[model samples]
Target: MSAHYVGQIAPNYVHSTMQANSDDDSFTFTVGKLDAGMAILIGDKASLIEFPSLLLPSGVSSGSVVNIRVMRNDQQERRQKDEFDQLQEDILHTFGQQPPKAPALRLRNVTQTSVTLEWDRLSLATATLLSLDIYRNGERLAPIPNPLHNTSTKLSGLDLNAEYTFHLVLKTTAGTLTSPLIKTRTHTISDTSGISVCFGHVAEPELLEASKQALTNMKAKWSDRIQIDTTHYVCTDPRNPGAQEGSQGAGYAKAMQLSIPAVLPHWIFACHDQKKMVGISPFYLDQDPPNASSIKRSVEEVLGKQAPASSATEADTSGSPPPPVEKEPSSATTTQDAPLKSTPFAADDVPPSNKESVGVEEVSSSAPPPPIITTSAPSEDGDAEPQSTPAPPQVVITSSESSDRIAAAAEGESTTEDAVEQTQTTEGAEEDADGEMDEVSLGGPNGDDEQEEERRSY
Candidate 1:
């Protein structure tokens, strides 16, 4: 006999009859089919009992007349009903109780098409947790093994520039418990390149590009010069302080200062996350990220060894050089020097040779600076003598006024002792009694030495 659920009958259930044919009162019986159901339903969806297989033990021969005993398992049914009612009550109690929350939800590698999301798991009891269901924008998505199992997933093919919210639900017989809401935005189809940057010698292009594409999903440009338009310098290796005398970046630090930010590759991603260009002093090659500094040695390192730095300055109306200094007349012994080869220089133009152009400049009455004496290098020809010019005419003065004039001329007009220029029209003048001075020297012929000595005594 098998139990059958009969909703309309007086008993409300039935002992199902077997379809069989009996030959005699105590003879052969061939039982064919028996209908039964509703023995046990685990979680209400799956059937746990199969009546066909429960007719007899597995080794019993079929179609044999056997004495059948029918009995009602009322006590087992009552016990099963009590258990199910208790389970329903427990589910309600747990549902009313506060649901355990998942650990922090973190996002990474946000691109135009996708993003990576990860979160920590809550250590809920096995009985309390049935399955974990992921939800995006309130829509239920895939289910995981359980809530206690922390996991990660790659969300792909999302709308560009659109924001999305995600969460997880702890599903159980009691009810569903939702995790904390995590808000995020997908990458947009951006064409803006943001800022220009250059790479250091040690910065690996492939690694940086991979990292960049993973985070930004865009191509980055690499520059050679630290132009006024450039904003950052991506460096892989550490840079030294340029205060040292022989440091390669010393000139750039001290004079030619480049104002561009010198940073690592992560700075780009960080700025993108923050949605703007923040302080990058912390991301220097030699310094830590998100750091600040007063002495920007990294600037020198990025600009390389030069002066007048590569940055845009305040007074540069147009990033061009001011006019050259006006030449003054303070010297006749002017020396010529080779010009500077480097196009960009600060302070002053540096000549190609180590020797600098230093000479006396001749000037008029309102001379700004006193002339500096310049010595000529020795002549290459051994026999050639140095060219010498006569000094100004010497005048013997009898009056104090004439003496004052001479003194004034000595202080102001005398550019060089070798070059003595005098006013042609002067009333107060008595030429040196030595008459006309000869250009005679020791080695040269001095046949009139006696006369010259005699003329010296006025």
Candidate 2:
């Protein structure tokens, strides 16, 4: 009933009769018409059957008598299936059993701007290798040359203290396989363990030995050859005698060509002492070492002198003598009018009980009394220098409000200089009445005793 045949039909298997049910298995027919690919046959009962024209007997024309037979070919089916099973077995033994394996990757070393990566030997599993590629952060970086022989790669030009992801892709006849992702972080500038030092023209043997010892203490590596892994070139003066020997002073020229950091032995020592990597610019071989005293002087020049002491005894007992007297304010200004005014006061006018408050101590020397120095308030500009004016001692009794303003400035309560100037102006207006009383109180009745005490102190 089915027109399509799946198994081979051989001539040897054809028969004219069957032992059982011959009428159904075999039949006689006449070819009615032949088309391009189909043949029409009319059976004894006039039943039409569509068959392939190519399968019909050769040279058979239209209206020809032919015998048609349909039977199941179990032997041919079994034979073909056995052959197919053998073919599949051969393929499995040759390539399918063990195919290409994924590449295994790991990080070997990490520096500030570079990293070294290594991997296991590639497992092709008898499959032909097409190519091997490396990927960084999901992008193809480069193809590995001679992939079967090479297993390690050094990547430079990376960012310092940055995180990166890396993987390996292997392409082969079996399939394309990829390795697991490896996350790595480059070394920071302060990590001294990443330092790779190479000894160059070091004149002193002790210096070279000490440098190697220091590198060992810091867990840093060093090599005699200047390779791509070498990070620094340690040496003395390259211009000294025998420095240019041994193929340009044991890799000094190569270091210069590669622009490696050429530092003196002290760099290693300093790193060992601090337990961290220091800057190479200050320890360059051609540059001189910095002087500690010179650095201190430069810092002092920038910040200026510190504030003077608050107590009078400390200032008087200081080792340095008091500053020489400069031009003084005129004496014509009266203390009764301006209590805080710049005016000269005779030694006899100050009361004996309040002489200590005036910052004048009785001394056994004959030297002239030290002039009082009243420094003017700083200008409104924060960076403006304070103006110092030499004025003779005068009675100054500041009110509570004025004292509060001075305390605020000393304690840095108001940051702006304008606030300090405004406060000083307000304090001046409030001191008018208090100034008159302060002067009268200080001008005591014992003028001769005050003069005698002042003369004895000077």
lDDT of 2 by residue, 1-458 (tens): 21223244524322322222355555566788998799997765466767788877777779887765556798878898999999999878766687777988987777888887889998887789999999998999999998989998878899989999999999888889999999988888778788888777777665566667667766789887776567888877654324544434536777788888788777776676556767788888667745322333222222333222323355567745445333333223323333332223334223222333223323212244444323233444644332332222222332322454333323322223332233233334434433533432223357547633532332
Q: How displaced is residue 412 in candidate 2, in Å? A: 9.6
List the lowest-lDDT window of 10 residues for candidate 2: 389-398
| Model 2 CA lDDT for position 268 | 73
- Model 1, stretches more than 4 Å misplaced? 1-112, 126-128, 145-147, 187-458
The model with the greatest lDDT is: 2
TM-score of each: 0.25, 0.44
For 64-169, candidate 1 gives per-residue lDDT tens digits of: 2243323356777889899999998897766555455554566644555455667776645333667887788999877765345546666666886788888877
Off by over 4 Å in 2: 1-98, 226-228, 237-250, 253-259, 289-357, 360-458
RMSD of 1: 22.0
